[model samples]
Target: MAWYATPGGLSSLSAPQLAAARRSYDLWSSGNPGLASKYSFDSYVEYAQQRHAESVAETAEQEED
Candidate 1:
């Protein structure tokens, strides 16, 4: 029911979901030694937003059937 913007597009991630993404990204980056060299935090956030959008769309499509 809520929306936010990322470089990828508009996203439906709520504040809590976005917070979760941040935490997840932080954890993932800390755990992966090569992470910091490859991607910036902003890029990771964008990726999470895009992934969340795809997940929402896929779930909606499945439910419509």
Candidate 2:
């Protein structure tokens, strides 16, 4: 588990997780008004989690090859 320092306090999310969520927001937040309105931090966090899993799987595959 990784911890990050926030303005309020420490967050359970790692630096990479936070970075991924921010990138996810930047990609999706401004495109569709409807989607943007419905999207939230929780959604971004989910995306980040999926993205991390995919990345890990990809790396494992590459190592196997």
TM-score of each: 0.61, 0.48
Give lDDT tens digits, candidate 2, residues 1-65: 32112221214566675776567576777776687788786665565556666777899999999
What lDDT is obtained when candidate 2 is compared to the true structure? 0.59
Cα displacement (Å) at residue 50, model 2: 1.6
Q: Give me candidate 2's TM-score against the actual structure.
A: 0.48
lDDT of 1 by residue, 1-65 (tens): 22223434225456776676667667988898597569876677777667777887899999999
The superposed Cα distance between candidate 1 and the true structure at residue 32, in angstroms, equals 1.3
Could you say which candidate leads in lDDT? 1
Q: lDDT score, residue 30, model 2?
A: 74
Q: Rate the local accuracy (lDDT) of all candidates.
A: 0.66, 0.59
